[model samples]
Each structure stands twice: as C-alpha cells, then as structure tokens.
Target: MASKNCCVMFMIFTVAIVQAVSYDTELFETAPCDSNACFDALHGALGDCSCNVDTIDYFNNVKIFPRIQSLVSKDYFRFYKVNLKKECPFWADDSRCAMKYCHIKTCSKDSVPGYVDEHENERPAEKYTKIDQTACSTDEDHNPDLGYLNMTISAASQYEIAKWNAHDSALENFCECDDRDADAEYVDLSLNPERYTGYKGPSAHRIWRSIYQENCFRPKLNPYESFPYVLSSDLSNMCLEKRVFYRAISGLHSSINIHLCSNYLLSEKGVDFAAPPEGEWGPNLEEFQRRFDPSQTHNEGPNWLKNLYFVYLLEMRALSKAGPYLETEEYFTGNPTEDEETRAAISNMLSVIYSFPDHFNESAMFNGGSQAAKLKNEFREHFWNISRIMDCVGCDKCKLWGKLQTQGLGTALKILFSSQWDSLEADPEQGTLPVRHKANKRLQRTEIVALFNAFARLSNSIRQLENFRIMLSANKEPEVKRNVFEGGGANIRSTKEQCSSGGDKPRIWS
Candidate 1:
C-alpha cells in the first residue's frame, strides 16, 4: 500500500511540475491535427468533440478522406458523430461502459529538442510499452495569428447564413416586385444593403435562426446543407461527423468570444473608442465612422468591409434574438395574422424585448447586454413565432391573450437582442466548434491537448480584444470579460466613472 501511494504521489507531482512550467507550444506536439495542430489543441481545450469511428477510415475512402479532411480541416471539428461513447468521460471507470481500444496508433516520435520530451515510458501506440514519451515540440512555423483565423470560420458560417438569408431575402424582395412597388428593390443579391429599411429587408429573426442552425450543425453536418453550405450526404453518415465537429466548433466559438471581448477592453485603442449614440450602435453609419476618425489608431481589425460584415452579423443575430419563437412552420412564414389574441401576443413580446438597450454600461452587465440579451430575445421570438403558427393550426389563444402573447414575445426578443453582452457569455462554450465532453474512447490525450491548446489561443485572442477595448475607449482598468468590444458599438449609457470631457465614453444625448 505504501509503494502504491508513493507511485500515485509521484504522478501527481509530475503533473504539478508540468503545470508550473510555461506550457510551450512544443509540449503538445503529439496533438493529432498536425498541419493545423493548433486547431487540434482547440478540441481538447474546449472540452471534447472527437472521433467516434473505431477507425477514421471506417467510412472514408481516399477521395472521401481528403474531402472529409478539407471539410474537417477548413471547417474544423464542428461536426456530428455516431461513434460517441455512451458515457461523457472516457476514463469514467463505469464497468458497463469501460473504454475499449479502437486502433489509432502513432508510429514514430520526433527527435527535435522539445519535439518529444525526454521519455519516461512509452506505449505500443508508439513502440515502447512504457507510459511517458517525450513532450511534443512546438512547430517551428507556429503562427499565433492563427487564432484570429476565427473570422474565416465566421465567414464560413456567414456564407451559410447568407445563402439562406439571401434565399429568404430573394423571396421577400421578389414578392415586392409587385406593381405597387416596381421601383422598389428586386431580388438582386448585388444590391444587398447593409442596413434594414424597417419597411422591407430580410427578417432578422430568420437570419439569426439561420445562423444558429448552422452553428448548431457547424460541428455536425446537417443532412441539409452538406458542404460549403449544404449537406448532400445521408443523415446517418453525416450525423456522426456532424455531431463530432459541432461539439468542437461551438466550444471554440465560446472561447473565442470570451477571449476577444476581454482583450478588446484592455487594448490600447480599444477603450479609446466608444459606443457613439442613438442610431449608431455598431451599425454601418457615416456618423459612427466620423466619431472615431480623429482619435483612430491601428492595431485593430481595419478593413471597412470586415467591419461591415461583422456589424451585419451582430445586427442580424440581435434581431433574431428579438423575434418570438414560433412554430416550425411559422419559422418560415409569418405567424397567424388572423386572431387578435395571437397578434397581441406578438406585439407584446416584441415590445418587451426591445427594451434591453437602456440597461447596460461598462459594468459587469456589459456582456449580458451585448450577447445574452439577444439570445434570450431570439428564444422569446421563436416562442411567439411558433405560438402564432400553432394558433392557426387550431391552438389559438384567447384573442386578447394571444395578441398580448405575441406582442410580449416579440418585445422580449427585441429587448433581448437590442443590447446583448451578458447573456451570450453564459454559454459561449456551447456554440464553440469543439464541445466539451464526449463518449469516444479512441480519441485520446494527445488530441485533447491539441484542442485545448487551440482553445487557449482563442482565449488569448479574446484577451487581446478586451485589452483593445480598454485602451481605445478609456474604460479605466480592464476586466477579462468574454466577448471583446474590439468589435464596435455605440454606448447608450454613461459609466458611473467620469471620463475626461469628450473621451471615448458616449456622451448621453438629452
């Protein structure tokens, strides 16, 4: 018993020592996703979102492998899987579900200085039966900026969202080709305006839901959209890969959101910028551009195009949050306009949701206002949209109640999306690509290390973003909050802390 205890203590000490030392990029070389090993680190860091197949080739032929590789490589681990274990943790020690080996062996170890740490023991997966192998070395060409590559992921998602949005917008735009509006915009995708015209334009609810749908399946292949945007494969084959990837991606997104937000607030130029004023809450506006021009500095994401797309993503997402959750059918079509009760419900819902903008500032509630508020708002609208559709299908509420319900639901979503900083922070991990925890036994420590490292990089990116916000807007000292404001927004409230007159703080309008 004494000897056994000593062994356990030694292992613990080893891990402790590993922790104290700076975790170098090389320390995780065994991380699987080689070429994009940092991405490999992301999976483990975020949680688990690994392979389910007994072997990777279970369903993949050479062509399929490369295709899946591209999808996996370009898309990251935000896909679904069937090989997921019955339990959450592989080492859970449940006799009934104990891990069974699934043949994913590595042949040789690298010899570079830190490529493989001095070996303690090795496994047949390597060539030795001992446990510790040299620590993996850092890739000489590791690019820290790879963390910012999230925009590429975002672009993939946006492209997916845009296709659907464009489709809906097309239909709506086409519908407006009526004689009463011949001069009105037609279904020209080219004329896709950055701003909504209140009277016409794509529905924000639809856009948000569409993005959520992609996000949901971002790691998992939706049997619907197969590749660049659609899933051409059968659900069975797709689900396994889809689920696996979705888990990882969502987790990654969460980390990225947090890291960026925190960094933005702390950066030199970040806090120097401010949420300008009314009609200028991070929207594409000339006034907003002018407000920061004099004090503008570099070291932030510069391109106007990039900023524009991000703004659109935020607005659409926020608007989506502002919507009432409607029935499946209502998700596409407007909910019943027939019953007064349903109508009232929709109206009330909308009113309540639009009210969130007034409550937030630089305090702790910022993220709640920026991200969460919108999410809750979207859920509320989803409820309304579904309720009305259900109402038409013979489940109508009392006339007054239905209308109030509809209105109330819409109100909630609007308020929810209007200023969403806090709520989004709550489950940022859930939406990231690689989700935490899974059932696969074959997926092991090395991959997890890779994934975890990726997540750390993402976390670092967010920190950078947070830093940016503090410096630019002069938000005093910075706190490490999720969702950096390196992205833009016009402040609606004054912080209790006074700023030098005309600093980045928004000057509240009378």
Candidate 2:
C-alpha cells in the first residue's frame, strides 16, 4: 500500500512540473524582456528589417535627432493642412476633449506662406524667374551681354515647370484622407504639440480597440487566455505583410504614448500660466512606468518599445530610398533664402542617414508566392482604412496628429511597395537617373512634410526613453495631489463640472 501511494504521488508531481514549464515558456516567448533587459538586449536585428535596433538608437540619438528637430521647425515643415472638422464615420458619438490642452490653434489665412497657398495654375512664374535673375545678378563673374537673359520661357517650358510643381494624383490611392478639401485649414504644428491631453476612457479606448480588432488580422483567442499568450500566438503565425502592418500601428501607438509621458502636466498648484506662458509640463515618471514598466503593464511594455524602433527603421528606409529625389527637390515657401537653407539642411541630413550600415530591405517584402499581389493590395487597403479611421478621433489635436502620422506611414508604404517603380523604369530617359529619383514628382509636398515630421516625432520618443529609464531607476514616486487644479477642492469642483455633468467622474489627467 505504501509503495503504491509513493508511485501515485510521484506521477502527480511530474504533471505539475510539466504544466509549470509550459507556462514559463509561454511567458518568455510573449514578453521576451523586462525594462532593464530590454534596454540591454535592444541590440539585435529587429523583426523582418535588416537594421539593428542598437545602431538605430545610437545614430538617431547622437547624430540625426537634433538635425531632424531643426528641419521640422522650419517654415516648410511647420504648417500642416488638415481637415480638422471631418466627422467621425465609425460611430455617432461626437465627444470632444474637455482639457484646454487638447485644442489646436489654426493658422490664419494671412499667416500661411503665399507660395504654399497658390494654386498649381497660378504658381507665379515670376517668382522662379526672379530667383534665377537675382542669383545671376549677384555673381561676380558673368557675361555683361548675356546678363539677365530673357526671364520669359516658351509655353512648353512653362507647362513642364507646372507639371513639376503639381502633385501626383495617383499617389492619392495610397492615402485615403482628402487633403485637398476646400475646408481644410493650415495648423501650425509647432504651436500645438502632441502630449498628455486628458483624452482617455471609453472614447479613446474605442478608437484603438476598433483599429486593432478590425484592421490587424489578429485571431480571436480564448476568453481566459492571458494578453501575452494572445500576443505571442497571433504574431507567431502571421505572414510578413500582416506583421509589418501590425507593427507599424503598434509603433505609432507607442510613439504617441511616449510623447504624452514626456510632456505630462504634473502640477497645477500655485503655478501661474499667465506669468510663465506655458503650463507646468514635464516628464511623469510614474505615468511612464504605469504604461511601460513590465512589472506594472503585465510584460507588454518591451514589445511596444521594440515596435517603436521598427517604425523608425521603416521610415528611415523610406528616406534613404528617396535620397536622390529629396536632394534635388525644391522646398520653396515663397522665401528664396529660407528655401535654399531648407535644401541644404535636407541634403546634410540625408548624407548622415545614408551612412548607416544596414537598412530595411523593401524588396524582401511581398514575395509570398502567387498571392503576393493580393497580399500587397490587402496591405495597402488596410492602411488606407486606418488613414480614414483617423477622422473618427474626437480630440482635435489628437485627430490632427493621427491623420498626419498615418498619412506619413502610408507614404512610406507607397515608396516601398508601389508598382510605380516599373513605370518609371520603363522609360529609358527617366531610367538614366538613379532608381531612387523615381519619387521626385510622385510625392506631394504635404506627404513629404508629414513623412519627415513623423519620423522626427518617433526619434524624439526613442531619445526620451533614456530620460524615462533614468527616472525609473531613481525609484522615487511623486507625492499624491489633492486635486489637479489650483486652490485644491474648490477649483477641482468647478473643473469637474466643466468637464462633465450629473455626477459621472471626470477622466483624470496623470
């Protein structure tokens, strides 16, 4: 009897050990790393991309970040044309952000550059002629007789110039948003930055939930399954195109969260907004940990951080591929001096980006057997749908950025996988220039501005991660506040009433 009991006990212990091992394995495969481990292990090659994450972090942090920041601050990149009033098509809810910070200040018509506002047909040829004439007049050595040679050109030449200035309508198929809407207004992105907007709860959650559930091809998992388990299983079997699509969205989401954390409104006490101008804004260490620390976020933080690097490489690859076109493309904004400076700045930035050793290979993607074309089209359509979904974002500032970044990613996809390459190559004369130059006239000015600014935003997020890491290591939690508003309870009561009515709690801004 004793011997039989021992045998049964041993068998039970063995089954329990097996189950424990399986659980551990699943956790490792899904989460992969903790905060410290992620920072240390961020060196390897990223999924499906040729570049190393460590290399990206180093170059972007040290060499490229400052330049890109400066580039985006320029006139040509600062003003963005977007239809902020577009209604949400997904749901009937038209909720707006209650926070004052969520509002975006639109540029007055007179504030926008004249050249940017000019129609293609009315581009004013004299502007180009004046620039050329000014340069010739300033030159020390020039033939007196050939001086100021006829500023006028033939009709054919004028037509060619106008064609060059006009945006390629075909690229619109890649992006779903109607950027040319007559109702669209110019918003100075410099004035309105992406940050903590007290925009959360059911409304904000619905936007992301819909995006992930509807767009990403993630399978429905068991209700009892852990998030890590679901994440691991879904990514394990997905094809390259699907994974790229998923990662791109995840990366963008991660970038936005990082921005909010970096620029959180920590205190409203005693702080005088009128005196200092800007509100009390700085990094919220506790918020960062809550969102990204593995211990706090159930091991999902590292995956999101990794996806952010993937997006940086993806956009970097696009910029590298389009180097030839970007180098020669004009950044005219009605000011000749600033335009020349813009060109030189872009040229220098491209040179530094081109120095990177390995880049994401655009050609390796979409090579899946006969279904390749179908998969490519599906990928484009899915992204197009995402671009449209941006219109549904309730917060004005959030929608502005959501549209810009999605459009930027869509532009990157077009550069990577579009069939326009074949048409460009078919012409012998066009083929004489490098293949990279094929994007010269294909991309719109808005798309170009969106692309570079979006990458700058991602780059800033990556750089800010270090600041967050240091803050985390300090291990100090901020003191609890009685209220977010000044004068404690009285102001808090009024603020709550302004945000909502009837006794429903207002969404807290951390």
The candidate that achieves the highest TM-score relative to the unseen native structure: 2
- For candidate 1, lDDT tens digit of each residue in 1-510? 999999999999987766433221111212111121111211111111122221112222222222222221211121111111122111222222111111111212231112222123321123321233343335777655563322223445546664664454332110111112212111111111111112111221221222234223332333322111222122233333233222222222233222222322222223334632212212221222221121111111122112222222222233233233221111111223323333343344334323322211112222455564443333333333332321221111111112222222223223333332124333232221121222211122122122222322322333333234334455233332323222321111110000001111111111
Q: Model 1, which residues run further than 4 Å from truth?
A: 1-110, 113-445, 475-510
How big is the positional error of residue 268 in model 1, measured in Å on the Cα after superposition?
20
What is the alpha-carbon lDDT of model 1 when measured against the actual structure? 0.25
Residues 1-510 of candidate 2 have per-residue lDDT tens digits of 999999999999997776444432212223322245335444687777677677788898898888998898899899888897877766777777777767889987678764454444345344455444544555568775767466667667777776764444443356754455788888998788776667765566556655655566554442322232226335656677677777777777777777776776666542554533345566766555555656533455677678899888888878877776777778878888898899999999988887777777677788867688777766766666667767777778888888888788888777777755433442232212245435334566778888898888888888888666665566554333221211100000000000000101112111
lDDT of 1 at 479: 39
